[model samples]
Target: MHVPEQIPDHLDFVGRGWHPLLTRLHEQLVAVSPSYSVQQVKEKYGTLRIHLYTGMLRHLNLGNTDWPDPDQAARYKDEDDAARALVHAAEQESARTCEACGNPGVPRDRAWIKTLCDDCAGHR
Candidate 1:
């Protein structure tokens, strides 16, 4: 029998969860030009330029609101609105069902309706 490897308890910036993709992204960001700091990067390029970069990054990772530029903020808002529309469309198209049990009812937690039953969601 093989034992599974354990993940560490605290992952701070990546947020708390078993997200390997986030972990991998964190590693890649650290690996590429590791010496530069966020402030340094921002200062090197003007604030607006940095904000543009931040907006691009925000699509990949949600919790990256360092110093958003006006254009970037607008772009992020648009993307968020589009995502909401897509989810609304999905709900309208699909039968009203509990994602886990497939029971026809309003989901207990709509945010996590994708990967969890009520019982499993609590435990996880």
Candidate 2:
């Protein structure tokens, strides 16, 4: 797969067609908060899967730091919500996009389920 330089190498496991989608999502996350980091990206049940992390979540995990005050916390929550919405949109788009060639597609069932265009499905 031709992984984009902006994306981490570990996420290259996902299909090439979704690279643009991933890249756009990454850019959106960065705009929301540069601290956002993608932990995983993959294909599951013929759809794209993405996992992400942020410093705010890490702070919460530490359970010791009152890192952000109430006002800041509310702002962070809004940003997080926006990020989640973006991810959902990307995943929904993936369902209709060919995993092999980025064309319009639908989920297909064989030995394994995959989202593919008619042409790409024929070759498989």
Candidate 3:
């Protein structure tokens, strides 16, 4: 994971770490790049940027962000976009489970829908 210096304060060190979904995605995209290298990971307005984020990420075109090569930036545009889709899917999966404890869950009616395990869903 290569999180940019500019990120929401909410995303501390823990957010920079690769989530289980990302680990799996990276393994799957080895053909594209030996390993995924994110150029940015930030929350826009209803979508995530470069990582699987079930918590806080937004986009006008949700799940359509890019993850260009940190070094080349645009050399692997297609490949990065493909990897970004995988990450997006994982984020969507997170919405159906608990981000805190990873248990079966459903969306709660808030300004934004967030899925949480029974134990972690309480009062959220």
For 9-86, candidate 3 gives per-residue lDDT tens digits of 224332223255445655665655443444455433223345522211222123546643465445455555765677
Candidate with maximal lDDT: 2
Q: Rate the local accuracy (lDDT) of all candidates.
A: 0.33, 0.77, 0.48
- Note the residue pairs that clash in candidate 3: 46-58, 46-59, 47-57, 47-58, 47-59
TM-score of each: 0.29, 0.84, 0.49
The positional error of residue 42 in candidate 1, measured at the CA in angstroms, is: 39
lDDT per residue for candidate 1 within 1-124, as digits (tens), equals 3221111222232212213322343344334322212211111110011111122443344445476788977865665454334333433322233333333333343443333345535554
Arrange candidates, best TM-score first: 2, 3, 1
- Kindly provide the TM-score of model 3 when superposed on the true structure, using C-alpha atoms: 0.49
Angstrom error at residue 47, model 2? 0.7
Please write out the lDDT profile of model 2 over residues 1-124, one tens digit for every residue: 2222334554568878778777788888778766665667789989988776554673464464677988877877887788788888999999999988889999999999999999999999
Worst 10 residues of 3 by lDDT: 52-61
